[model samples]
Target: MWVFWALLAAISAALVIVLTKAGLKNIDSSLAFAIQSVMILVITWGVVFFQGNFHEWRAIEKNAWVFLIAAGVFTTLSTLFSYKALSQGPASVVVTLERSSLVIAIILSVIFLKEKLTWQVIVGGSVMIAGAVLISLSNSRD
Candidate 1:
């Protein structure tokens, strides 16, 4: 089930990259991101309200709130940077570089979340970063 959800998220992200690139042709990346952020806020809150989870926010602990707020800030930064990159570069190249975050996420997960670090994960992340670098370099030559 988790794998299914992950795959769905991946697909949705792909769509977002393509659609956002197309939409940014005439718009400033920051403005485009802001427009999309508004939609995200509305849709997410709508879901929470529909599910009767809007009041659950009061139950969140201080630490959880801190982490969530920090995550939100980082998420905004990440999206803004990605949008700027996408506006200036090819989608394929920008996305490949952005996907390198997987390696950083794995490292942080192991250190902060106490997640198991397997050889396969290490090798896979290394290969992924290498591939992203290769793709980015190749794009630069063209």
Candidate 2:
């Protein structure tokens, strides 16, 4: 079940990158991000309401609020940078680099989140990072 959810998240994130890049070609990145953020906020809040978790929101402490805000800012910056990179580079290269965030996430999860990296994760992450490097350097001469 957890693996299914993780796979779904990966697929969904890829779709988001492709769709966002296509959308950004015509619209301003900030405008696109604003629209996306609004829709996500509405849908998430709606789900919270449906789950009867609205009341629990009141118990969220100031530190939680700060963390949430920081997360939002980080997400916003990520989107902006992605859009900018997409605008400047080939979509294939941009998408590949964007997906490299998985490597960053794994590293951060180990460092800050105190997550243990099993041998499988080490091997998988190494392969992925190698692939990214290959993709980045392979076409440089062309």
Compose the digit string of candidate 2's lDDT tens values, residues 1-142.
9999999998998888788878887777777878888889899899988998888878999999999999989988988888888766766677787788888999999999999999999899899888888887875555
Clashing pairs in 1: none
List model 1 lDDT by residue over 52-140, tens digit each.
88888889999999999999999999999999999999999999999999999999999999999999999999999999989989999
Query: Model 2: runs farther than 4 Å from truth?
Result: 139-142
Lowest summed lDDT over 10 consecutive residues: which window, candidate 2?
Answer: 86-95
Per-candidate TM equals: 0.97, 0.84
Candidate 1, poorest ten consecutive residues by summed lDDT? 49-58
